[model samples]
Target: MLDLHNHTTRCKHATGTMSEYVDTALSQGVSVYGFACHAPMDYDTGFRMSFDELQDYFHDIETLQERYSGRCTIRKGLEVDYLPKHLDSRVLDADVDYLIGSVHFLDDWGFDNPQFISEYMRQDMSQCWQRYLHAIRDMAKSGLFQIVGHFDLLKIFNNPPDDSVHEAITQTLESIKSAGMALEINSAGLRKPIGEIYPSKQILRKAFALGIPITFGSDAHAVQQVGFGRESAQRLAKEVGYTKMLDFHNRSPIVCRIP
Candidate 1:
């Protein structure tokens, strides 16, 4: 199995060290395990690693990669939040294995935060949904990321908007396809209150129909959670007619069989 979205204590919200996660991946028999901790933002968010700590983050991952050389492939990546003008350009220019673009905030208001759920509720649900989709499309079209993370994270509250957002969803998928970026079938949602994978079955079907390549991510925050829910993600992919999943190195995709 291959899992590209994982977190470490550097992300503040997650637990475990890079070595611990690597050991867990080895135990899970994961063929390729990536440490994609939240990328450092220019300002303090208290959730991501600070810019000053980014070098050490890279060093730690590199050290682990050498330490576990022949046992399993360990990659270094970042779960970069797309904030339009706010993102540091250096992150895109960083020498990393890959980048996972995600939208955790809707213009500064973190819609996925449990503490911010009340704030999300105060907005017009329909408009908020549309805006979230737009942000995703913009992120895809930006041409900076290799994969899109948690495709429908705005539904974190379990209160989905009406079905009138079809056009927006279509555009987002099309943008991802046109950008030649892969979409992650993230399993972290199962741990959330929503209790389902990100990008839901509906979105996954649309992405499959659009010919967008897919990848698997456990989005694990702890050592024990590494490769969590991969079996369910694989079944979902096959049900949607996906025959191959993507693996990345130096930001280039390598096709792998869906097993």
Candidate 2:
């Protein structure tokens, strides 16, 4: 099994040592486990690792990679927020196995943050969804990432998108396909208010139709959360007719069977 998204204490919001996370993945029979902690940005200093800490994070992962060299595959990555203006070149240009591009804000609004969720009540849901997908499109077009994190994170607060959101989703998926990026079926959403996996089944079916490959991420922020919803994620992938998932090694794709 492979799970490419996880966090470490440096991320400021996650708990546990990096070794604990890797050990947990090992206990869960995960053959390939990656750490894609939130990459630092000038805008969200409190929730992510700082630019100065980037090297330490890299060194920590490198240590784990060597420590568990023969037992398990430990890959390095960064979950970078797709903030065009605040994007840090250091984080973007860092040498990692893969970068998972994600969008957690719409302009100045951190739409998915629970502290700022009340803002959703004051705006049009359709427009909010549209803007979020457009941001995803732009992120995919940037050509800096290999994976898309939490494809439908905008629904974190349970605001399901209507049919009108389809066009934007299609456009975003097209951009992702054109960029040769894979969509991550993130399991973190199941632990959120939405009570489902990211990218909903409909979106997964659509992505399959477009010949888009996929990857799996637990988005684990804690020890127990490592490989938390992997079974469900795997089942969902099979249900959507996905027979293979992408793994990364030094930023290159390696296709593996879903089973």
Candidate 3:
């Protein structure tokens, strides 16, 4: 199994060094080891790291990659929040092997009213969905990431949107396919209420119809979380006509057969 999305201590939300994660991957008998910590930016957000430490993040991972070069294939990668308004082009043009594009916020999703956040947290499942799919369309057009992370993350905190949302979801997926982008089947959502991958079965089926390649990621934030639900995620990919999981080398996808 392969894991493409994960975080380390470099990002405020996670803990541990590159080596610790690598050690866990080796022990688990993984064929590939990826270090996709959240990308450091010059922003002042609470979730992202400072760009000043970007070099440190790269340096530390570079050392671990060399140390484990013969034992395991270690790679340097990042999970970037791709808001075209806030993303600095220089950050994307860094030395990392590849990056995951995601939009955690649109102009910060900065709701001022406690009620907006609470209401967002409490919307009649359908209303909250209207807001999320709108956000997703904007994210897809932003053109900042090659792999879209958590195609339906709003479901993580709210209720699932219905068939009405499928039209917009399909349009976005088609655009992603036309642009030669891969959509990720994130296993991380299994811990949530739906207990299924983001985008669900219907969306996955639509993605296959649109001719998009599917990728799988644990979206792991800790060592033990690495490769979580990966076997099932692979099976889900196959159910939707994808026979291989996505691997990136020099920013281009290199498909690896799933067993």
Candidate with the greatest lDDT versus the true structure: 2
Query: What C-alpha lDDT values do all the predictions have?
Result: 0.88, 0.93, 0.72
Give per-residue CA lDDT, model 2, range 12-45, as digits (tens). Answer: 8889999999999999899899999999899878
lDDT of 3 by residue, 159-249 (tens): 5667777777777787787667778888888876668787688888988887888776777777778777877787887887887667787
Ranking by TM-score: 2, 1, 3
Better of 1 and 3 by TM-score: 1
TM-score pick, better of 1 and 2: 2
- For residue 50, model 3's alpha carbon misses the true position, in angstroms, by 0.5
Please provide TM-scores, in order, for all candidate models, with all chains considered together: 0.97, 0.98, 0.88
**What C-alpha lDDT does candidate 3 achieve relative to the native structure?**
0.72
lDDT of 1: 0.88
Give the lDDT ranking, best first.
2, 1, 3
